[model samples]
Target chain A: MSRRGLLIILSSPSGAGKSTLAGRLRQWDDTLQFSVSATTRAPRPGEVNGQDYYFSSVADFQDQVAAGDMLEHARVFENYYGSPKGPVKTAIESGRDVLFDIDWQGAQQIKNSDLQEHVLSIFILPPSIKELHRRLVSRGQDAPEVIEKRMQKSWDEISHWDGYDYVLVNDDLDTTEDRLKTIIAAERLRRPQQPHLVDHVRKLQSEFGDRP
Target chain B: MSRRGLLIILSSPSGAGKSTLAGRLRQWDDTLQFSVSATTRAPRPGEVNGQDYYFSSVADFQDQVAAGDMLEHARVFENYYGSPKGPVKTAIESGRDVLFDIDWQGAQQIKNSDLQEHVLSIFILPPSIKELHRRLVSRGQDAPEVIEKRMQKSWDEISHWDGYDYVLVNDDLDTTEDRLKTIIAAERLRRPQQPHLVDHVRKLQSEFGDRP
Candidate 1:
């Protein structure tokens, strides 16, 4: 029988290299997969249906919520977005680790649910707030006022660092990426992942295996 | 204020490439230091006095055990060996991560003591029992019978793998080393390790910091 997969939840503030590290982790290991979240928000022009996200109507999302199909759902910027419990459960049961690149709030919601033990949490922090603001402005995705709002949001997000099982400081992308890969490998070897090995080894004794 | 360094306890079977990984970890990060254990066993001719193991007398070891100066102590192969609590306390207080290349039993003793919260436990496993036996025999220092005995001991040692907080499978040496390094980096960014940064960032509020 194939062993089950682990659930890894990674949370980070804006500009903390969460997406970058998550991408590298998936690339480094084929057994690891990403959980595509479902969203009620309309997808932009270039977004693919399943590749980008599982797009659904507001009504469909509400139905999933009411039926307990959504693992963790939230309303953001006047639109609802959530992680579909079905795909994640299927992936893990079939021996593929699912990576969740969600925020601290979403991670907490998932942790509070029945899937808590399956989730391995990691929080990322920039080396300093000064560096965080610098990176956010460097991206140039937002105006000065919006950047200020993001900076404020970062503080509140960073305060939840202690809630995580592991924390990574994004001082350099290369080093941080390397660390993320290692964490995945280590967590994969957890005892629960290799239950059959113990019995398999013991059975070798009955087969007259080579020994002293 | 300086951050407190974490005490990392690594336990694994003898030929699981743990020492190689631990050595590479120390080379990659200067902030990490090794905890030289004290032992009553006679040092080999080529073994350096303080550099290899702190050569202590049976009486000296028992005295420390009675005085409660050792973090963890035990007798192995008719010789007393232990880790002193004082040096570990001083090193961690000075912001240096101390590594304990110990067995699971010693790690358990440390875990039970007051150092439980600060301790990060990692257990290493070889990819397979066949691979482990190959590595052990390849060393060529032991006879066939001796290698078999060591393999049996390795099985006993690995049976307690679940006691660790993290588990690393040494399938690839370089990858395993990288994984261990990342685990250390992630632990260093934990909230308890960054207390000074809390108020330090608050000072940057006037520059652009606003709490959401």
Candidate 2:
């Protein structure tokens, strides 16, 4: 009796090293399936269309949301982004854990969904605002104005850090990554996650009864 | 803002290797305080008065139970066993995790305690009934009738395994010990366990506000 998979949601402000940590987690366990969100926003350079995100038209995104094909969707300023329900449903039903690297809003939406019981949400915090700003600037990916806007968005995300199962401060990448692995490994041993324990106990019961 | 410590409750049927695993956990983290139980039963040879069990007379045990000194207690066969509340309260208040090697009834009582949010309960299951019997018989601690009686009690204890937060089948001692350590380590990273994280984020918030 195999159980349904967990939805491992990782949320962090920009420059908090969450994306890098998520990548490390996937490398640690290749069984983890990354959830690629569908977005109306244009992909940046080097961003693969289907791999990075399911690039979509606003009309197509709205249609999917209306058709109940989106598990959770939100309008982030000018663009619509959402987790498509189809792939996630298929992954979890087949007993493969789905990893979600989303913001606080997406995490909240997924936590409020019908499959909320299977959700394991974690929030990552950067060491300091100065460090966060430094990392964002060091990325060399955005202009000063864009980085400023992201800094404000980072604060908004960090404000909701209280609403998570586990919260880790990214003071050290190696330590934080190890803790993430430990959390995932331990979560797998929980009673609700291992349905085969039922059969094991039943076998023990029969063996107990058979001892004459 | 240091948080109050967790109450780690470990339960298992006899001969399930819970004791050895618990010993290993204490060795794994010396900060873990073992909540020694006071019992009305007389001490066996080599069992320390305070370290192993706080052997008390029936009247003394009942008095403690009535005086609200006992956190949780129950009569097993002819003897009363209970966890004293004084040391556990002090330990947790000072920010030290306390470990309880107890049965399911005691685990249930602690879960209903006011400190329920801090409770991390785990149950260990033996690999097989035949293996459980072999372990019991190999111990050579009792007569055949006593062994038979304990076998029945083991079954009763295993029946309540569904209530624990995590359940592990003790097929291999080292693996089970490692899993127990992982569970404890991961639980420490939970949001409620680290109240100091509040201070951390507040500092970050100030840092954010100070940025021109």
Candidate 3:
């Protein structure tokens, strides 16, 4: 029988190269799934209706929250965003690990959920505040005021970094990417992630019993 | 600040290829130390004094045990065997990972020791009991009764496989060797294993503080 899958939560502040790393991880293992979050925020330009997010009405988002459909949710500014529990549960139960690209707040929620035992959370840190600011400003030509606001928000996320099982500084993209792959590959070998081992051992035991 | 090292514990039955795998692991990384256990048993053929086993007198072994120099000790049939606590404490504190090739009892004792937090235990299972028997018999032209006794002792060890953090079936030497390397590489990336990360983050914090 297939073992249960890991939550594989990846948390980082904005512009920490988490998105690029996540993309690389998926390419390395196509079986790895991205947990598409549902949000009440209007889609940004060039964003697909369902691919970027499962856009939902404010009322529907709240309804799912009330019905316990969201694995974790948060109100960020004017929008409501969350991971729906059904797809994640289905994917994990079938032994397909689901990757969550989320902030610490959502991470804490899922860690406290019933499926907490299956969660493997990691936090990524920027090499330095200077580098973080560089990436933030490099993204788009935002006004100085907007950039300042984003900087404070990024710091807010970085301050909560100590809550993860593994933390890596995104010093070099290639090094960080390779390290992430190593972490994932090793985690898959953990005892809880390989239930079929029990059967293998049982077969050996029987084989021993039948010996001369 | 350098992080503390792990006590990499590897346990398996007599003929499960644990020795070969351990040899390959040491070859893969010379810095990985083999924890030379002190035993009161007589030196076997072709075994070196310090490299193979630290052959000790029974009185000396018991004295070390009484003085608490032994990390974990156990008696098998007639002889006492144990891991010395001194070298391990020094190696780990100095950030050099130590490898322990001991039985389940010693593994459990170390897991319960003060340095339990630094322990990373793994168990190797043979692909089949028939193969295990084949390996045991193939070693020498022993009497059937001696082989039978060995088989029972091997089963005794195999029964405790579930206590390990990671368990692998030794179906192929190269595959198991690679997997062992992967486990070690990933474990090194764990949060607790990287104390210098704290300092790095503090530097980043100061970098942010200096910003306008």
Candidates' C-alpha lDDT: 0.80, 0.91, 0.91
Better model by DockQ: candidate 1 vs candidate 3: 3
Which candidate leads in DockQ?
A: 2
Candidate 1 wrongly placed segments (more than 4 Å) = A1-8, A15-34, A39-68, A75-80, A93-97, A117-120, A124-152, A166-212, B1-6, B15-33, B39-68, B75-80, B126-152, B166-212
The segments of candidate 2 whose C-alpha lies over 4 angstroms from its true place after superposition are A1-4, A40-50, A55-69, A140-145, B1-4, B40-50, B54-69, B76-79, B141-145
True contacts kept of 3: 0.81
Model 1: pairs clashing at backbone N, Cα or C within 3 Å: A182-B179
What C-alpha lDDT, on a 0 to 100 scale, does residue B23 get in candidate 3? 93
Which digits, one per residue and each the tens of the lDDT, describe model 1 over residues A45-134? 999988799999999999999998888989999999899999888987787889888888889888887767677788887877777888
TM-score of 2: 0.88
TM-score of each: 0.70, 0.88, 0.89
* Model 2 steric clash pairs: none
Q: Ten-residue segment with the worst summed lDDT in candidate 3 chain A?
A: A1-10
Clashing pairs in 3: none
Return the interface RMSD of model 1: 4.8
What does candidate 2's lDDT look like per residue over A1-212, in tens digits? 47667899999998999889999998998989999999999989999987999999999999998897887899889999999988898887877889998888889989888778788999999999999999999989888899999999999999999999999999999999999999998887788778789999999999999996
